[model samples]
Target: MNGILSMPGRSAESLVDVPHTLEPPARSTLPPSAQRSLKALRLSAGFWFLIALVGQWLFAWYIAMVYARPVLSGTPEAINNTAKITGYIVGDGLGNSLLISHVLAGGLISMLGLLQLWPWLRRRVPGLHRWNGRLFLALGMLGALSGLYLTWIRGSRLSDLGAIGISINGILILIAAVLAWVHARNRNLGQHRQWAIRAFLLVNGVWMFRLGLTAWLLLNQGPNGNTAKLDGPFDLAWSVGCYLVPIALAELYFRAESSRSPTRQWLSAGALGASSLLMALGVFGAWLMLWRPHL
Candidate 1:
């Protein structure tokens, strides 16, 4: 990043793209099967994002309905009915404020962050994309900061390890957000896009957590290695896995997209396809068990 920021003249004209940039394909040495696998990988990635967007929008709606609705209705105490922790505490003005900002901003960013990735939107309405990107980054940072404060300072987490998981997520969010902005400022669109995707994943960590939990419960027909207090083994592991899994998958997509290896492409394609299937099931479980009940 210093190399990028410290480039001699640092002008757009003088800047060079990073190796990972999704440049147009050179004439392919790839066989037809590899080409087909690459195509499948792209499609599967797109499908995964599409499913994620649907789930996220539903989650945003859930946040508004469950959290924001009460505040707007002058019954902020109603939040405690559905919220696990950090709900309206009558005397804790700062804590309540942070809770509102964290959840509301979370909803906004969930909807906005992914839009920045739309190629047609970026190409056709660059101005909107830029402005939306700025707002998305701002809200994402706010959400991360507020969430960390709530988790650690306010003691909103269910378990110590869970708090650590969320804390790690917050740090990743900050790093990714900063890098995304810096790369954009440097006119390095490839790196910017990569970092932005990471920021998106990190910001959506809570959503992923809920999805994973619901999926697990549905699969097991009940909790396994779990507890009511969220101190169970599965809960502790998921604290990190929620964000890590998505980002790791994204990295695999990046590697597969860039590589000419048929084997890598096929492997990535299969992995992405399986992940999409799991995510789809998770989304269903989340909507059925977590979100829809409240709505």
Candidate 2:
């Protein structure tokens, strides 16, 4: 057998002459902490996004319902001014008509605003989204221009500030929307998406203000007790807070996602957690006051 193995055509090192031991397969070696951290990040991101969406929707619905009917009745000065402004542009006898039209249009657009966040809707309804977006832009321009005219004619110092805040926000939203459309047309999806997010947040200003007021009132005991009236510095502060806070949050979230740095991610997450806690406290206080009876 040894002579055969040593033959010219056969080598002694061949499988026929030796047994080889196979090495065991290498095992995955990820540390437990790394795995846990990834899971935690994913959960945190999902939770934060959900909170933003739900909070936005609730505020939108409340505004649409409250303003739609009361503004038509012409009971409050604020509501009266809104109605008169709408009426003045078109004509008298059209005050309620204009109010209804604005509310209905605003409500429809705001409703779609929520859907724009959905990945599927954003992809499938790009054209429809763009069209509705144009309508929203037009509505904003008309509303803001009319609001400016009326503000000049009838706004109080506080009302003037409020009107200016809303108008500025409106103009910003219009610019952002237009830029988003242009970027989309140029196939610059990243910039387009960013601009769209900004526009959507601006459009949500009124909703945010309402929520902030509701929150403040709750914390202070009730709407009546809440000293922060819908005027003057309070109104301006509310508007600024609503617009700036969300944008700040979105920026932090984007930064965290891009950096992939644990420190940044944790910092952003903590800020969001604190803001959410404060909002929760406000909401709880408001709910308690709203439900409680007056002695």
Candidate 3:
């Protein structure tokens, strides 16, 4: 009764103004592995995007001039230039059409893929995200299919192992795309994100090829300095390593994030840091020795 009548001397306003006990909001926490993974990703995302931008533009520029000028103005350098294309340019008919479609769409696809991973854009402009996602998926499938055809049916300059490696990459891209779509359909955004990243890396595997080749050349002292041509030891190594290695490391990161092992966290952090530095070097090598001269 005394407790019930405690406000008897107080005005209604004073009673209502009394502070009430409420538990503070729970503090969000991430495991150490996850924290390191996120930090590494954040630190590298911008640099990765810059490298990707260079890659897309370089591809687009080389394709347009090499293919278009030859057809439009009868330029023979087109042949010489396109001979440098990793998969080798398909001169005419269906192959050319597919390759051209990929060339024209590749940059847009990459840009949209990057944008789709943006949380703010996804929340603020969901329609744009959905449309871009569809376009990215469509272009990615077409590009990978054409690449597979070129590598297998049209004859690649690499060894049989390299061709097989490329085919495996193509298959992986298809699998990643399908998994991403399924996850999106099931409303599992987290799984969708993982699969989408896998697909993005697969789609950009050519960047690694370009970067690796340039790094090889630079290390060996430029074009004639290196005995490795289209099918060298380094090329052979990177053919499978480019896609597979990245995927493996990504999976390792996800495992660490889930398990939250401190040892794994340190290992992942060290690996990611070193890899990012190497990637920057790759970009620089590719730019200085390979694409820059052409531009």
Q: Which is the leading candidate under lDDT?
A: 1
All candidates' TM-scores? Answer: 0.90, 0.66, 0.73
TM-score of 2: 0.66
Per-residue lDDT of 50 in model 3: 46
lDDT of each: 0.81, 0.54, 0.61
- The residue-by-residue lDDT of candidate 1 on 10-48, one tens digit each, is 342122122347852552666787777767767677677
- Which regions of candidate 1 deviate over 4 angstroms? 1-20, 24-30
Q: Count the backbone clashes (under 3 Å) in each candidate.
A: 0, 2, 0
Q: Write the per-residue lDDT of candidate 3 for residues 69-136, one digit (tens) a residue.
A: 56557543354564544432446466665555655556556445666555545666789877888788
lDDT of 2 by residue, 204-281 (tens): 665566667777665555544223335555656776777778778866755554443556656776776666666655
Model 2 segments more than 4 A misplaced: 1-45, 55-98, 124-143, 146-150, 153-158, 222-229, 277-295
Angstrom error at residue 139, model 2:
4.4
Predicted structure 3, TM vs. truth: 0.73
Best by TM-score, which number?
1
